[model samples]
Target: MSSYISLIEKGIHVSEKNVCDQDKIWSRYSHDKVDIGEELARVIRTLDKGMPLHAELRALSIGSSDEPQFRILETAFRGGLYLLDINDCALGIVQERIKRQRTDHVTTIKCDFNRIFLDPQKARDFFRDRLGKRWVHLATLHHSLYYCRQCCWLELFKNLYRGFLAPRAAIHAVLMSSKSKDPSTTTWLYNHFAGKFFGAYNDQDLRQLKKDLQRETVFKKAQVLLRTNRVNFYVDDFEKFMAVVWMILLYPQVHRYSLKQREEITQHVYHHFWRKKKPLTQEQDHLVVYKGLGRRGLI
Candidate 1:
């Protein structure tokens, strides 16, 4: 068997054990609310060290944060493994990282206006090639856009599971987020068909003019797809990889949860999962007391 296949089989075989250990390392999945960052980091390191080439890692998340995943990515990248995840973090950071990397080895699938704006012909062609005859429906395109917008990741693999490959393969899978709506984002989606899919530079009149002309073409394309009743928007590929990133970001306590939750989950894993057979004492927790920490957000 290939190294990647071996790693995935191992991950699947041990997944139940990892989840059902005596200590609650996977409390977050059960909605018990615990931070599993350290445990996540430790598992990633072990996998990288052990498998080196093939290790299955998955991420799950809900919310708009990237700092935690950034830390994981930094660690993995520095470790020379470059295997990581980011679920619901800001998409811009993900895009920026890929742009910075700019290599053929990395498979980057995203549905951001910036990418289309930067290169519309390339974007359209990619969808056409990936989706084949299915790229005829507006709904499919919209769903594809959402998947890329929401679910995106970069990785290396010989073959992917059906969930990762199927959606982009034959049909479009629609996924909707219940998160609070943003007017700017919503507006961008509604105007997806406009000739200038991307917003104009800082000039307001120029932006309006661009949208006006593009809306005509957008409507024309939509009408054509509506008549055919067949649409394809490669949502599956985008989201599966996205799930991977989200899982990586969630580990190491980057998203919402109390500090107590973080420590409890960490302690549970280190003690129970690793066969240590003892709780982590307060002294072993290591609370770094750094000063100059200011309020976050509003940035």
Candidate 2:
């Protein structure tokens, strides 16, 4: 198997364990402070103001795992939701949770965005049949872009634009940005430290994507905004944080590292990246929101 696929499988195993032990996972990571749902709700409310009350709003949550973000979206959005993810375990957990809340309005699809993007016609037919429509009013990829292969990210965006998005629809995504003050420094560090990771996006890639969106014929008049925010990282222990980071970064050949090397990396991360106190101070993240009202409401 390819290294990326192997890493994804490992991540799935960890995610399955996390789903099994929800409290343990949340207690270790500071995900509670990340209010992605509120941000998404605000954007939706702002953009959806002029539409008729009964216009039938539809929203999509890509990489929708067993996270609170999906539940929050369920409350904020007026119409049905199409939840998509590659991890079957995560999907099943999310499916059951949403089923408990509202069975009729939520649909879970076990598939990767890369596949859908590659096979546009199949995706169009599948989603159209499930949604009873070809377009969605809003789509979210919250912290999910990092899971896509680097080269395919822009293609994924273009395919999504072609197949699923409504003419006046928008896509909101939360991405990991550089922490350094210098843009060039950030780019260099990202390419050096995380270039090997699947779905990793550096500063340069993001800039190129912005330019590409402007040039694309499908997204004419698209207003894209990339915002940066520094949020507090609260972790009770360093060991737990390191495990989370390993899974998140999908560190290749972790077993190859010697005991001394592992310790060195852990210490570096703890002292440099992680905060020391409660609501630990750490590097901030970048949130990118794209709103495209395709030319004359057509792709």
Candidate 3:
């Protein structure tokens, strides 16, 4: 068996007491009933979609880098993956297991995150000249958590894995929260609730999920995603794609204005749950401290 499969088996079979770290995590968030693993998974996927999968392995190209990219990477290292972006100054030797881990055959595509430009040509050239067809690239986009908040893709990912990973705090919030949760029942109901809320089996009322549940395909797919961090490979599985799509749906605010736009909402709901009510000041013991903005009364 592959090491990745072994890791998945361990994750699938581990007892709650053995895998859960509620006490240590609760102190940080205070009060929440969601699953930590799911939450961490969302945050990791968000970070991965926002930046390179292995930014920690590369040197910081000091420039106008986006915050979400940095934020998610820092979170993932803390959650599991084991590599720290040098940009995360607060992190040191906190994770012992990750220190022994190694990353290979990975390269980040450099570009200005602040700018919006489509380069199908450059992308094609990268594959032609740089990474061959066999090489996989998770192209991340640096978007403002505020401007581009409707993460339907994220909600999709969560809903797909809601059955298995929902026990984790992050998935709990996504599946149970007002926006993502089904309006009715709430009692660790993954299959029923997700089908009702996200229309996983109902898009055309095909009811394909009945067969899918028996196959346990989604669980297998989530295992692959957890180990490899690649979503583009499983195009054949619409259910899996919908899970990632759900994650995208959960984004707080969406800047893209189109006719299909459901409502004029921007900023993710989760952002409000944890967004800073006030700007950074000397009083806050921030790990990434910055000098207060100079006088015009705005710093």
Q: How does model 2 fare in lDDT? A: 0.57
- Return whichever of 2 and 3 wins on TM-score: 2
Model 3, CA-based lDDT: 0.25
- Per-residue CA lDDT of model 1 for 1-299, tens digit only, reads 48534433333233223211311232212211112244334334433443335433222111212334334534443312221123324445655665686522222233432343234464446445533322210011111222332212111000111112222111111222222133212122222212132232111121222234235432222111000111111112222221222232232222432444333433333233223322211101101110111211010
Question: What digit string (tens of lDDT, one per residue) describes model 3 on residues 31-114?
Answer: 222222333335344334434445432122112122223333334443222221222222332222124443222222343312
Q: Pick the winner on TM-score between candidates 1 and 2.
A: 2
Candidates' TM-scores?
0.21, 0.74, 0.22
Considering every candidate listed, which one attains the maximal lDDT?
A: 2
Q: What lDDT does the true structure give each of the candidates?
A: 0.26, 0.57, 0.25
Native-to-model Cα distance after best TM-score fit, residue 194 in candidate 1, in Å = 40
Ranking by lDDT: 2, 1, 3
Best of the candidates, TM-score: 2
| Candidate 2 wrongly placed segments (more than 4 Å) | 1-28, 31-33, 178-204, 252-256, 270-299
Output the lDDT of residue 35, model 2: 51
TM-score of 1: 0.21
Model 2 scores worst on lDDT over the 10 consecutive residues at 182-191
lDDT of 1 at 68: 43
- Candidate 1 residue-wise lDDT at 140: 13
